[model samples]
Target: MTAETLSIPGLAKPASRIALGTWAIGGAMWGGADDANAARTIDKALDLGINVIDTAPVYGFGHSEEVVGRAVEGKRDKVILATKVGLNWQGGKIFRDSRPARIEQEIEDSLRRLRTEYIDLYQVHWPDVETPLEETARALENLVKAGKVRALGVSNFSPAQMDEFSKFAPLATIQPPYNLFEREIEQDVLPAAVRNKLVVLAYGPLCRGLLSGRMTADRKFEGDDLRNHDPKFQQPRFDQYLKAVEDLKGIAEKHGKSMLALAVRWVLDRGPTIALWGARKPEQISGVEEAFGWTLDEADMKAIDTILTRDIQNPVGPEFMAPPARNRVQGQ
Candidate 1:
């Protein structure tokens, strides 16, 4: 199956419909990652025609970018290198900090870690209310002017916030956690993106593996595993989501596919969305081909919607994972 592509300004080639996400390989909340396996995963993804790899500084505190750097060595031109800034770590605590000075410094750090002179897409990981939007936007624009970044994007921003950022810089894309379980963006962010012609890169397509269909009731997460704190993984909610997953599994079977493939296919079926598939090992992504060459028709979409509405009665968004903005001092 040939993967679809989205053309955005500044990209030498159109981005693949499915992009390899490096969050798990970063080994922070998802547990640690093996450098060798992560490298192989990147190679496998590119070999399978996946051209975009997204990472962030807070991901393993720079470990993911480093691993991606080594993996893309001598092949940087083959992939669309995407990374982010604005979230900083201090004394083991992460906070939002998109101040202009910080942006200036972070670009250099990300560049060095990724071993690339230019980043294909540089995004603001999250909004920092403490800093003026102009400051952050101007900093990113400067990177484009300097030829350090190819395009600009913002994740988890509201329509109004995106408009504010667009006043200062050109936004080529928008990243948001979007999946069958979390459709909040449909109410606003997505419509705004569509109107503006900005590519939508949907992350967490499987709701962090909840819809992966392999999760069992007795499944346990340990040692810095983020699922430990995820609401969907908690009791009551976990049970409800798993029930929906089970039902979704039957639907996948109707299409001769697995729940994982169905979940990703649903996102792509939404049209113009580049699903960010996170993986730590090549085997985890080996099933990606199963998600292509097919799509959910209106009936399939309605059936999935009916399943979600009936089973996931207490659905929730991914707000709990957001980092707090930087605090201001009295007399700074």
Candidate 2:
């Protein structure tokens, strides 16, 4: 089955509802990545009708974008390239920096790494409290004028931030973490997107693989896997989430879908225009087709919520994933 598609104002064509997220493909975190396999993963996504590919400069400090560049080399027109600026790393430390000068330099670096003349969608990875929002917005606006970027987007920005940012530049999309296990965006972000008529790109659709039904209690993480520091992966909380996943299995079975597919479908049904599915290898994205052409009804949503409330007594948000600001860094 072909994946569903959504239209963004500036894009030449509609983007696939499911975007291939390349955080893991960066090879710095989530164990490691093999270049050949990563390319194969992108090819697989294209074969399965997923046209939008999302990446960031900091993902492996630019390795992910390079891998993506190679993967989509000859078929650039067949993909919607989405990447981020802001959030710079120095001497092994990462911090938010959306200063115009920073954005200027980063965009060039990103374009070179992605091997593209213009990005389809360029986003600010995170809000930089230190820099004036107008400065960052204007810098990105410059890119649009220069024909280096087609559309503008912001990820992890609050409604107020988006309002301020839009005052200086046109905002076409808002990307935030939204999944079955993480619905924090529904509280305010989603509403803001609706009011502004911005397309929502919901990342982390599988909640970092916790909702994939493949994670086990005995599973172990190696290398720089971010899950090693995630609160939900800790002992008591991990067990709690696993228990909820176990109960949700019956629901997935009832729908004749894998837990991963159910997770992505839930995000799409919740109103996001696209669900960013993170995958580093071909087999990792095997069941993506199943997420399309089906959705959860009121009773299914309510049942899922009931299970979450019953099993997870100490629920948590994805706050831990946020990086520290430049000045907030220790011993700075």
Candidate 3:
């Protein structure tokens, strides 16, 4: 299987269009995870030609980075390490904090956890309304100047925020929640990235497993699984999404692919994007190769829209995943 590739301006090698996402490997919110399994999963991704590993400190409260560090040890040069700053957590509560001091501290911590001298793609995890964009951008700019980071990117940022962020730093990419179910970015965020010539790291390509073809009506989420809180998983909405997923099965079968492959293929065919595929176990990523080497034409695209419109009466975005701001936490 030939995976599509994208070239970032400063990176040494082209990155696979399908990036390995470590949010689930963190094992904090998505039920639980095992370190050994996480390591194996990372190794499997690398073996499959997936060089981009996207993780964050808040993921499993630093556990994810530690696992990634150990997994990529001695092979650091082969992987494109993409991690994030901003969003501080305390007592299981997370809030956005992108002050210069916070960013400065976060980079060192990230480097130590990732066990790397320099981060290939260092991104601000979210927009901090409390901190001025210039301050955060300049702080990231200094990292590039000091050789601690190679490129800068932002996640969950609006076009206006990117405009302000670019003034102080050369923005290379943007990470946003995007999938077949949630397409809020199509209105403005995607257009802005195109205008700015920024590569898009489209996360949640499977809609948090809803489109993966594994979910069933009787399946249950345990512990603090974030899916339990997702609106789409609730009644009525859940049934609507499931029906759409079932209807989408024919499209997948017509293309001789699994629903997971079809879902991710749809994302890549939408635009210039690197679809982030989240996994905690090696088997979960087994069919990743299927997502490549396929393109959905205009008719397929139109049929997908028709199925979604016919099955889903109400649609929801991934806004529920956003962490609260510092001010909101303080008020409580």
Candidate 4:
């Protein structure tokens, strides 16, 4: 791979520093998706040396995985395919369920949708407090031993949760929401991943497109766009973040990179094992090369810190988007 790669303890191969994220391609929360274009984007990403492809069943409710399956038909051996479990949906309402039976059934369903004999990495999409950590870990461990999954991972799990999970199974990776704006994980999850020797696959490196620098005060998010509910997209907060983006233009120009590249590069420089970039079109990845072959210097980091501290007076995390556990669900 042209992009730098990192070796995880139990993974079959090192993954590219940039992984093609498929949430947008799922054609759900982020709005419409063109399957043909998405398949082409996947091909383009592989040709560009991005070897890791991350998706989930909840993303478009298996539509993402199906599109991914079509894209990797002949090139499965050339990439590291990662998808997740635990989250389930019915009639467009999402809920968390990590019961052993659900995990078993979902693996087969995922395998069928992915059209793959075995998944390279199978992660728990989110923690299910109703399900015992041991139950989930044991189920994941069974899959590994049975050769259905090459590695086990968990997403959005805290250090304490991971500690309990480790008692029953080995955690190969930690997939969490991490970006310049969402620095909540840096203080704990990141350090825990390092200490536990789990690879950190940081999603939302572009902060759900806010860091793209193309977002303006008048930009509109329509349909079921998830950003519509994000606090960063709300009035005063949106204006403040946009101002930060405006200021970041100079920093990006100084480094001879676009805002998108600067955002991705910053995440890579900040120590994530891999930065997952979500894309639905080939051109969206045109600036990916800028994320490589350069490192953000101390001055650059300082400027970013200053801008964030001064601009975002009321910062927030991705906690608002978390799905409800089975026990906590009011209705069905």
lDDT of 3 by residue, 1-332 (tens): 56789987568789999999999999999888798989999999999999999999999999999999999999998999999999898788899999999999999999999999999999999999999999999999999999999899999999999999999899999999999999999999999988888999999999989999999987799999999999999998999999999999999999999999999999999887999999999998989999888799999999999999999987989999999887887663
Off by over 4 Å in 4: 330-332
- Model 2, range 107-131, lDDT digits (tens) per residue? 9999999999999999999999989
Please, what are the lDDT tens digits per residue for candidate 4 over residues 88-120? Answer: 876788999999999999999999999999999
Question: Mind sharing the TM-score for model 3?
Answer: 0.98
What is the TM-score of each predicted model, taking all chains together? 0.97, 0.98, 0.98, 0.97
Question: Whole-model lDDT for model 2 versus the true structure?
Answer: 0.92
| Candidate 2 vs candidate 4, lDDT winner | 2
> Of the candidates shown, which would achieve the greatest lDDT relative to the real structure?
3
Write out the backbone clash pairs for model 3: none
By TM-score, is 2 or 4 better? 2
Model 2 stretches astray by more than 4 angstroms: 330-332
Local accuracy of candidate 1 as per-residue lDDT tens digits, 1-332: 47778897668899999999999998989877789999999999999999999999999999999999989999988889999999987776788899999999999999999999999999999999989999999999999999999999999999999999999999998999999899999999999988998999999998898878889999999899989988989998999999999999988999999999999999998857899999888888978889989879999999998998999876899888888767732222
Clashes of 4: 0
Winner on TM-score (1 vs 3): 3
What does candidate 1 score on TM? Answer: 0.97
lDDT of each candidate versus the true structure? 0.91, 0.92, 0.93, 0.90
After superposing candidate 3, which stretches have Cα over 4 Å from the reference?
none
